[model samples]
Each structure stands twice: as structure tokens, then as C-alpha cells.
Target: MDLIACHDCDLLYHQPSIAEGRKLRCPRCGAVLLQHRHDCVERCLMLVLAALILFTVANAYPLLSLDLQGREQDTLLITGVIELYRQNQAGLAVLVLCVSILLPLIKLLSQLYVLLPLYFGWRGWRLPVAMRIVDILHPWAMMEVYMLGILVAIVKLASLASIVPDAALYAFAALIMVMAATDASLEPHDIWERLSKTR
Candidate 1:
């Protein structure tokens, strides 16, 4: 893959080979600029480690504290789901649990599923199915969505009570950042390159 840029203007283009479908260019400048990253697997692994740590913190502690009507209350991530479940919104509660809890775990696990084998240079087994699962799970891991939900709840409840953000909320935010970093750092071309070397 050739990364071409205009000498006269700051335009980038992804000069593709015959096999790479089609060439691409910078839309704004039309200078053939396309974004790409190098050493994606290595960078993604680093981000994954950070995300794992943040995920642990998010799940292990209270997300927020509230004082209302002369009473104190704190809610963990699971607690919110439980509260929803108790309110008879079983489906919504389950969806929350799935998105908040299960999806992150699946994303982490699926990443490991690919990373570990690739790291160890294992090419004996088929990974296409596992890759598909990773693709499906990536969109479902909604740390940012959960963070927005928490923020909205805090804003809506602030008029009625005193609220304090907790460490877990910060951790959740960090997890979102880490996930974004993983996506930005990981290059599909690098992964394919590694696979080609393995073959």
C-alpha cells in the first residue's frame, strides 16, 4: 500500500494496488489523503490492556452517590439494572444488563480470542468465524452509551438531590476512551500482513 500526498497541498491519498478494490483520496482537498495506522495489533493490544483495567474499576465500585430526602443512596452498575428489573421492565433491564455487562466482556474476550492466537503465531485453526463474532460484538459494546445514560440521570436528578460522581464513573469514561484508542490504533492492513507472514 502506497501512502501518497500532494506536494503542492496537504492532500492525502491511499494509492491502492490492483487487488485492493479501489483507490481513495481526501474528500475535502481531493488530494488523495486517506487515514491509516501502522502496527495496529501492537497498538490495539496496549489499548485493550488499559480498557481491561478500566472495566474492572467500573464494575467493582459504586458509580454515583445521591442524598435525597435526608437519605443517602449509591448505585453500582448492576444495581441500576436490578432496579430496572424490580420495576417490572424485565426486557429493558435485561437489555441494560446485556449491554452494560455482557457486551463488554464479550468484546474483551473476543479480542483476546484473536490476539492470543496471533501473538503466539498460531495459524493452524480457522479464525474467520471468530473474526465475525468480533465484528458483531464491537458495535454492541456500549460504554459510551452507558456513560451518557449515567450523565443524563445525574442531570435529571440533581434538582431533587445532592449527587456526587464516583471513581467508577471516571473509570467508565476511561474505558470508552480506551476503546476508541483501540479502534484508532488497530489497522486491518497490519492484521492481514501478520496473517500473511504466518502463512
Candidate 2:
């Protein structure tokens, strides 16, 4: 038997075997204690794969093209980071790179590493560590915020030059949505239960 504590009311209860599409709630405060989503692992795995493909496309293509004075220039996702560094804004460059690029990549890869093996009924190597990393990096992956900043910059620069959204911009937008779906579909309690059983 397992035990769970209510986060809102500090009420303790025995964890029950909840069926898929079901939720366990705290009796006193009515706070949600646990939820069992149907086919969460499989759904999350597919979403993660899609997110990875989109990530690749987002990084490879130009996010936007600028045309001014009969000259055109293309900018990839990393282009802004590079420009920031060139402008001697090293701290801002690193912050953007970490929050927008590195953290998201790490979180996706870590989810893949953990979920892929678990889906196949095998325990992934260093499963706990990978899952921990995923939880830790969740808040730090700020792709949507970065996308907002890009949009703001585009609006500000519209009067100076013609700005055309590129393949990477669309891909990045899709990636953000897909990543959010993946997070929503993931059931951490189910994952931990599977991990414990496989050990």
C-alpha cells in the first residue's frame, strides 16, 4: 500500500489504485491529490518525438528574413544570440541561449530517454536522474517567452525594414504548442510507479 498527503490541507490518505481517466481527491479540502490519465506514457512519447523534429526544423531554418535598401538577410534562432554577443551583451546572450535553447533541448531529450525505455517495459539507465532533471528544468525552459520577445522585436523593426516570417518561426511556434501538450499528457505518478515496479 502507498500513502499520499494532500498538498493543500495536509490530510494523509492511503493511495488507491486509480483507473485511467480517474482522479483521487482530498476528502477534506477537495484538492486534487492524484490523477491517472489514460495512455499518458504512449501519448507523451509521441508528442516528445514530434517536438524533437520540430526543434530540429526550428533551429535549421531562418526564423525571419529582413529586406532593406535592396539587401536581404536571414536570421536563424541562434542569430539573435550571436548578435547579442557581438554587441557585448554576453550575459543576455547566455541567458537567452539557456532559457530558449539549451534548457528546452535538455528537457525534451531527458523526457525521451526516460519515456522510451519505460514504454517498452524496460527501465531506462539512470531513470531517476533523468526524471529529476526533467522536473528541475521544466520552469527554466522559456521558449514561449523567447517567441514573444521575437514578435515584439519584429513589430518594433517593421517600420525600418520588411520582415518576413520564415520556416523556423512557424516550426518554433508549433514546437511550443507540442511541448505544452507533452507536459500535459505526462503522468509523473504513473511513471514513478512503473519505474519502481521495473526495478
Q: Which pairs of residues have clashing backbones in candidate 2? A: none
- lDDT (10s digit) by residue, model 1, range 1-199: 7775664476666755432333355555555333344445666777787888888999999889899998999889899889899999999998999888898878876676666667767873556555567678878877678788888999999999999889998998888888887866655555655666766
Candidate with the greatest lDDT versus the true structure:
2
> What are the models' TM-scores?
0.78, 0.95
lDDT, candidate 2, equals 0.93
Cα displacement (Å) at residue 157, model 2: 1.4
Over the stretch 2-100, how does candidate 2's per-residue lDDT look in tens digits? 889998999988888887788898989998777887588899999999999999999999999999877999999999899999999999999999999
Off-target runs (Cα >4 Å) in candidate 2 are: none
Q: What is the Cα-based TM-score of model 1? A: 0.78
Q: What local distance difference test score does each model get?
A: 0.75, 0.93
TM-score, candidate number 2: 0.95
